[model samples]
Target chain A: MSHRARSPSTALRPTRRALLAGLGAGAASAFGLARLARADAPPPSGTAVLLCFFPGGWDQLLLLDPRDPSRFTASEAARTRIDPRYDELVGLGYRPELVRPRAAPAMVLGPLAERPGAAVQLTDFAGRMAVVRGVDMRSVSHEVATRYFLTTEFPRGSLAQGSSVSTTLTALARPARPVAHLSLGVESYNDRHPSRWSALRVTSADDLLATLCPAGAVDPVLADALDAYAREARADVYNRRGLVDRLQGARAVARGLDRDDVSRPFRALVDDGPENDALRARFGISRGDFDGPRARAAMAALALTSGLSQVVIASVAPAMDTHFVGNAGHARLLGEGLDAFVALLDALRTTAHPEGGSHLDHTTVLAFSEFARTPLYNTYGGRDHHSAGSCLLLGRGVRGGVVAGATSDVGMVAVPWDLTRGGASPSGTVLTPAHVAATVAAAAGLDPTAFDAPPISQVLV
Target chain B: MGRAPRRLDAGQLRASLLHATGATWTGDRRVRTNNDPSGYALRPATDLVRHYASALGEPDYGATTEPDLDPGPGFLRRAQSAAQGACRDGLRRDREVPAGARRLLRAVSDGDTYARAPEAVRANIVALGRTFWIRNLSPDGPEVEALLGVFRAVTEREGALPADGWFAVCVALATDPQFLLY
Candidate 1:
């Protein structure tokens, strides 16, 4: 196989027709032309991406990368530095055993996946899900590891060095969405991509409403004057940095938010009217629980279904950085996050897409944490941050029911894995977040080479 | 080579608006919570500014080292939203004072219309131009006429109150790019 490295600017050439079209009457300035020139042709597949970030390091042993409890018992703790201490986990709702779905005999999920309170279980989508284990995160610091995974570029002194994967995919897809990228309770960076592709970051539904809703009632005359004056003033100004045009475009989007009544569906979240009773029941969103994982998942569903955004990065899980008695709640925390992810999957599956099948058929989901916890408990009875991590990729172009990569038996360290053959290999390449990102890019119908890493082709259909 | 123009960040924008208009975008006042020993007597806009800080490209000061000076649509919308509230308060404050003591709507009186008092209305537009953008304009110039055009159009419309023109003028000045950008 051969590949040529190209900058994002020159990777795909803009045809003369595209160039002329992009250079609209209003966008004739050098900066405007340059920005529009970088605009990507829409992806051929019309695939949307949902990047689910599980904040804090999650314990993979309890979920995606569980060890066989019968073999790695406490009695063999000395030989194997790892411990399947599920017995010590308090308030654990399910028995400490591996979940081997009959449909997917090759896949083995941990007991925590079946932990109570989750509306949807991991095993529910067994045939459609794919798990990539033993990813080498390369850093244990929360900030470092998170940015590394998010951008696939290691942070320079905890500072993100590149655009987030959400921004990248949004730039590639360039869907004509009101808010192209919506980020709920997640950090999104756009260092190189156009500012329009930047994440419209909000912590909760109310915050999102505040961002999208028009300002409070003003007299019609005043509103008309403000609108007319703004239009006239903007027309006269030509900002060298294209800020004027961007601002005008932003204003138009704000008007569109009002014109289309985009905030109507989201208002159902805060309003406890009978109209929202069905929505509340659908995502398990309790009254006034507008910022929880379930609520975020519901918002993700609505955002995608309503064509409000092209990519959404939602933190569907709570912080699992349990280094003390907090570990007692580790299973619950991890379970709730996974449950939110499950709910999101269910929501995608049940919701009908504009094209034909369910939204899940066209959406790609990548669920990850900064890293995983240590194999063994610390003195505080909780796990410390571990370098090895795992991720879940499924839906839209992913080869389902596949487990690709493995950690060592003793120390739970990431070992070399054959991307092609799907197991530990002495001479195989070690999986990293870069490879995971590349695979998602590939799954989204983008050239994974743009990420400068090869997609694990074995995981793609 | 000339340096490129950079935008005023959220903090700077908020401060400038406060300094220029003497009113900020106010929201519901903060009340005492169980976690608070002394109830926070913060001004109304304090919480609002913080709430929409990210929307306006204010850096979190920890992870984000510099403000996001992108001037993107999100920032523009939030800024406009904030301006709506602040300009309303500004007009209210202006109306409470006598014409001479007013910060905005200086030359125009409560019942002044361009048809009845065109000179006073044009003078107020000139005053607003100076206050908002530090620009001096002739009363007959296209700039003042443009503002008068807004005023004339508003007051001429049915169901329009005379004060609506001034409120419109207030919003137009405050939200204009000349006032927002440095």
Candidate 2:
């Protein structure tokens, strides 16, 4: 409830002994950690957060939020007589003739409607997923919408931005991990979290490799030269305690890295070979594009399993600013990307934990976009940006198979809907980006009240 | 004349070696891409030292932001991943890359003193010190005298590979905070 930032420094850094104890009374050797002796580990219910972003805006009409098609059919005029907005869609590009609404039980599914095979892998785990269609994103501009969606801070001021959901969740995770937040080609914002907890970014496995490995060492004789000169140089600036401390701290980390035992695992992860073929397969990296969502998924699994990192930020597909290609382009990209995303979910599900259950059972996923597309097609045959956006949340502690919120048939504006129940006929509360954000924050062990919206408890298990 | 910073990253450390000794990499094996976002051409070690840029195994996820991850703005600000003593023996005591080492010694030494051991030692010290720090050097300074003593002692101990001792001496100068920071 307080605006104060969380600090774990006062808490003893997780000791190997405590980790073993918390591994629970029965199974301490979940991932063969009986000998590893890692400490201060989270309980079995502890969650990992995966923030997957696809750029530009998504077309909810053809994706998660589809309009009901039963209103039309036998008498097209009769359809809108009951709901006049359906008749006006003709002037817009809502081609009743071309649009085919497939029957998905109890939920408005679009990607599957147009094409039966679209994102079919998702069908198996649809029970674990929840989609909220009517989100009044407030801004239709891509930059503003994107920034607002991630950081619940309003777009009124530029510098008013705070730590993004990814950064916040990353900082909230176990602090003892060697690499806490791993950003694989993700653009994120952080405002005043602990210095060390700042994100460690790498674009690809190669970047990860480069970061961990040193160029060859300087000559031994030259090393001594550097050593002697450094010691003497210290006295000249010894009075500047701040500078001296930074230098010493930096040196201490470097020293720890130099040890062969300490550095070997990092180096091993860098160089890819046959051993990683299965991982490459798991994330659906067939051709092995390490910058794709597949790569992020592959590397994220490694980071979590290796004890190298906690929160992983990544993207599923890019080039979403589809002013040129329209729904055809959007559908093509989303279909393929969703397949990769499903593969990632499967991989996460397969990853074994030291405690009972798969990694997905302990992981939470947020798949989002800035906003949705205009219900009507534009002159260029593509959809313009709209304020109504759809967001998806899945994984541990999420109440799945639920759809929240609705949109008007005419302009596709997010309509008011009931969020809470008991006294009122309808719990009509328009879900904003803040409520969505807070729901995610609460799931990740953070105080949601720090942001504008309270947690939408209905979605939480 | 003074400290450049608390530490210089590995790339700067390598550049200091090449610059201080006036060593020319004559092989001309160009390591950098024609349009590498990072201005500096990469050596094998330099490649390892540079922050992630067009690294192998990376995907082409962007139609915009070529080379990925908004690399241009932060090209100059790659943080220090300096793994302490991890790279202490980067050049390796065993590998014999002699021609480069020989050329370095000759370039730093006054003419004719390079081949004859002990003759060009002091002039070489002043020359290397001047370039390594990117400033003029006074032969009278205690740091210079102390560096000269280090070279002589190392040269004696390295009887088989006496040139390495000189190379080691240069390493000391190059890794100095003044040499690293600026």
Candidate 3:
């Protein structure tokens, strides 16, 4: 009932040779067939996941998918029907230009990528990043699009239709941690997985501590009595549909939480200690910014490095629903989020993993928004929802500095892409959320069939 | 074949506790003192029902129309926390009044230890089982003896007083599947 690994000693251990061979085969051919070819082998272990979500639709032209200013100018806007008014963004003090960082020339990013910041920028990690452009979200509504991207399955109206990718990864992971999956200020859904893999959702570090820490410790006698009664009652219950069993299992988890003192590290979120100061400074989080993107990023770092969670999903951006005048500060909001994301990557890059490499070497980071904004600005001087979206996949098992998929030049519609060749093709498939989910699953050595879409072979290492 | 039983949602659980014991679990707002001058603020004392509503499978109706019917580990642990807090409140209220006027511990007093008064202990256990579970438990039945085992362990081995033992019994009965499920 606990879902704890029964024979951890006999669990499948991933070697460097197996990982390279698996990823090589996956990248060379369709992951569906490749996974079937190796069906007898277990998924590679020691791979962690960090799923970063930026709320509200991000403007594709301003970030992941950029248009050359010289080609799509104001005069050509009428013919192309796409206009990125870079001159209007006065916050950057200059008309932002598309940047291809010298280190990662194949990765084209928007102006915000090169923004000056106290923390690192997206350009810092471009060598380890892969940009998936022109992804079709299939929905225009915020709730529907968010869930669609989160679970890689379209929602039944506003309700999620599948288990979250994080939950899936956590369930498949062997030698589980105390809290296998942790979600901070992000929605996580679990449909059919074991209840133990359900994400421990919290808004902040303080909230996590409060949830894990006992309100008031009862006398030891009372504690012993309650635990004993629970055990006796557990045996008596018929466990219809495993409800009582899950309840009893959760009581054990509660006890483990106290026994392991899992809340001790989270206490540094508010406590004034050397490690707390170092984390705040490293993540570029000020004293009062506890629940912002930077703080969430710092929490993700601690969760991963401290071995508290195997998969962490955090909302690294404030709401960027910039419809009217709010659009003026859209770049600033996105810049802050991107800065926090890079800081998280830097933290992982510097921290050591238990498996003899940096945490970044063993972790895969997927950054996405619900959808992208329209190519053309709306009548309200801001951009509206657009069906075409883009996402970034970085860290382990991902081919770095590569761009896959593309939108059209005129309407910014997603064009059919050659998954194996990494370009546009008239007969190829259009990129969708399912493809991205499959790619993530495959990179983590999970079965791509779980996502019902073939992994994009060109994006894998 | 028996039809599967449905677990109570957070709202129904709260209402049931209030209806049965005339008490609800309410978490107090305690100020968090930290060395950081900027992170210091007066923490708001929100009620536990609202705080644990999401974990208790209560639907907001915006994203989900129906409550999460499957009770998982998170839901069960939160339910236990709620029961622990609510039963403590019930015991506190019972302790403030005379034995005749008590709502939960009417069959026994705070001073009635298992060694001193075993009949009163069995009576209190039966009364609690009937109050929370609506089942007429035999005082000498295995069910009563199992709960008595808990009381005996607490009072004898743990060296806890009768009031603490009663609180443990109250929590066990309230959080049991018989009380949680309809």
Candidate 4:
């Protein structure tokens, strides 16, 4: 490993490195790069996780932590709710009557809590949905808290050591899939995961489909030449020693992918085939929502259904960092971004899984923001950052009907909730991100002890 | 004892192709160190070229933690798709090579570079043996004769452009089993 250069290939062939140096830099703005970083071993499962991330510190008061109209008396709500940054809360604009009842015992709803024609939004899943409120995310800073939520480990020191739940689950679940982990617009991290298990990042559904198929027919001459070249170089490569191991690993991957056989099945996904069009239509892909959150969801559905990948992560940005003129934007996100996910839920429910149950019956959708918005608005006429928050999850194997933990009526202070019962209790521990990590680990079939925290058992089947 | 064949990385593969075809593009700068992960159309980053880097175990020099590629690189934590992707990219290149490189490959007359010329086809095969397989081929060596055999078959197929016969020579020498394993 000394600075010694690649041992000159004593081969009579011209020295490759020296020759390349003779060629001047061709026109190339140079370019541009997921591997997980953790050591824990989570067991694989047929169940998968579709994380719908809501960035920019979502509003807890309007979404997860509902408060009474009395508590928001106009004069007090509009004038009093303030953050340390001197930002003021925007006056509550939605009709008090619009706040509906949740399926959970005492929980109620906000504007975003719309159900398909008044079945009581979020109620049907009440028995299975466990919302852990009062989570002290420790810091209100955006970047750090976002990392804390995704990795479970503290952001201060875990940069090189942490792995996200999506990646850990990906490693555990699909060790041999053609593309095990697929990230379509997800805010992802892949530090320690081997380059082999690294994530395939795509921006659109077409991009996803095109990747599997070829440009056309492959040439035999070229194929033969490449085969010959591989033979020659592969031989000299072994003695090179410094890099042979990884080269061998890459070789194994190539052998597994049968270009003609493996990708031929994927043409159905690419050609706007009837089945895919129907599914896309069901997922709101026909509407402009295709470019919105629904697009990512559609890609996820295709990936899972096609067996192209085992884990698919999608994200949406609500710009909930509402510090200026608008407070109604979160509502728009509810209708536009959040509702797209509902369409996704509907599509998954209708799509049948090859193994028996519907994709919805086996896939779990985990949705949460970096942190919660301040219950009170600051002087900027919007909610500032708040450390306490809640999240929503749905899909098969997830206990969807109940809300876990609680927060206060005034400052939106999180109240400790009992994990066993999914209810507020003075004796309960304040839920932390570790609990979220454990919840995913447990659901995905990992040994829960591998994680430092326990799963919210009340929510798991 | 036979050992596992070492999978050559993108840099090595590109360089070997250039040398095998006698294109003055020696690629010394490239074979020693990677240009950048970006130049590689494979991996998760590019929209094109899938399932090659990881399978071949081509270390994404970019994926490694050290900013610069360490000569003594370790497994960068996970597997990537490498093997087949390169196979596809390489062969596909022959049909779609840049105009200049195509002309250069056609101009390859030295038996030492491609081993197709009857006068030095044997010498050419022997050179490939030493350079690619890291061994010597004796006079009337079986390896050289095998390469010459492939050359005749290919030249017959490409009757109009008989130079293509050299491609067969290049390929046989390149794909030799002894040359493939680490």
Q: Which number leads on lDDT?
A: 3
- Give the residue spans of candidate 2 off by over 4 A: A1-45, A70-106, A112-120, A154-160, A214-274, A415-432, B1-182
Residue-level lDDT of model 2, residues A90-131, one tens digit each, is 333333322322222455565432334333456566677777
In terms of lDDT, the poorest run of 10 residues in model 4 chain B is B24-33
Q: Report, to 2 decimal places, the DockQ of model 4.
A: 0.07
Return the DockQ of model 2.
0.12
Which prediction has more favorable lDDT, 2 or 3?
Answer: 3
Alpha-carbon shift of residue A98 in model 3 (angstroms):
0.7
Rank by lDDT, highest first. Answer: 3, 1, 2, 4
lDDT of each residue in A126-149, candidate 1, tens digit only: 788789988999999888898899
Ranked by lDDT, the better of candidates 3 and 4 is 3
Q: lDDT by residue for model 3 over B62-151, one digit each (tens)? A: 533556655555566667777777777777777777777676787887789999999999998998888888889999998799888877
TM-score of each model, in listed order: 0.81, 0.64, 0.85, 0.62
Ranking by TM-score: 3, 1, 2, 4
Q: lDDT (0-100) at residue A311 of candidate 2?
A: 76
Q: Model 3, A1-461: lDDT tens per residue?
A: 01122222213322422322222121111211222122222232378899999988888887899888888997998889788777666566534688887778888887777775444667878888899988999988888898888888889978788888887777777435667788887777777777777777766665566666653432444555677777768534446566666566556666555444455555556667665676677777777666778889878876776566778899988777777743347787887888888888887887655456777888988999999988887788788889999999988889889899999999799999998777899989999998998898788777778877899998899
What's the residue-level lDDT of B144 in candidate 2? 68
Score residue A401 of candidate 4 by CA lDDT: 58
What is each model's TM-score for chain A? Answer: 0.84, 0.73, 0.86, 0.73
lDDT scores for all predictions? 0.72, 0.53, 0.73, 0.50
In candidate 4, what are the lDDT values of residues A100-202, reduced to their tens digit? 4455655565545653343223445454455656777887877677778877777764232366667677766644566676666543454445444445554
lDDT, residue A412, candidate 4: 70
DockQ (C-alpha based) per candidate is 0.27, 0.12, 0.36, 0.07
Backbone clash total for model 4 is 76
Top-scoring candidate (TM-score): 3
